[model samples]
Target: MENEKETPEERRERLRQEEWKGNPTGNLKDSTHRSSYGSLVDFVGGMGWKGTGMLIILIIVGFIIYFLFFS
Candidate 1:
């Protein structure tokens, strides 16, 4: 029998499914497979001053775009 090689995405999905099956409650606090944004939020929150600086920069950029195009 020829073994079918799984793609990276397929492997990731399979692993995610296995994780879900192992934890039917879907409680993210105990799960290792956090969503990308959840990981980002956790990282930013941990950064303290650096996180605040990034957020301020993002808000400034948003205001610039809004005034240039929308207003």
Candidate 2:
């Protein structure tokens, strides 16, 4: 019996082929995977895009006021 030795590039190509067979996209997919971060984004997004934009702008203004005056 003989073992075939492959080069690094060949091994990488083989792994890529296997990965593409599973998920063509570069993103990994796991059935059990639920992101707390994405949930938070969704929660904030429920406030509506316009409201979210206003809230973000208010936060920036508040920070500028605090830093320039209070600090």
Candidate 3:
């Protein structure tokens, strides 16, 4: 059997596919896999669309209350 060498791009694609398949080996760290959002965004995303809207509404209400009472 002939062993074929994979290019860096191919290797990254293969690893990304494996990660999507739920086989996280934890050997390689790919920048693309990292989220750009901070913990707050991650929390809001985890809550789904409806919860995200609700969170936004609550934040707006809180800001309004803060400005009216203190600022």
Candidate 4:
């Protein structure tokens, strides 16, 4: 600390750069979020049953894989 020599503006800009280094945000809104809840419900309901069936299929397949390949 005693030997540090950065100017205040340089220090402030460095701090700003450091603060911004790891923060990432999407540059735009998802098209999905732009829809109303009613639309979302309709969209999700349209696929909900199929997705649930697929999930069950996946769980069964995963168990098969575990026994055949791992156990």
lDDT of each: 0.68, 0.63, 0.64, 0.58
Q: Candidate 2's residue-wise lDDT over 1-71, tens digit each?
A: 12158755456557767886878454344222335235544456467678888999999999999999988
| Candidate 4 wrongly placed segments (more than 4 Å) | 1-47
Candidate 4 residue-wise lDDT, 1-71, digit = tens: 72288765457556655655644232123223444333443454455678868977999999999999987
- Alpha-carbon lDDT of model 1: 0.68
Question: Model 4: which ten-residue window has the lowest total lDDT?
Answer: 23-32
Considering summed lDDT, which 10 consecutive residues are worst modelled in model 1?
A: 29-38
C-alpha TM-scores of all predictions: 0.34, 0.40, 0.44, 0.33
lDDT of 3: 0.64
lDDT of 3 by residue, 1-71 (tens): 22168755456556667786674444234323444333453465467789989988999999999999997
TM-score computed on alpha carbons, candidate 4: 0.33
Per-residue lDDT of 7-49 in model 1, one digit per residue for the tens? 5545655676798788877846535467533565446555666
- Report, for all candidates in order, the number of backbone clashes: 0, 0, 0, 0
Better of 3 and 4 by TM-score: 3
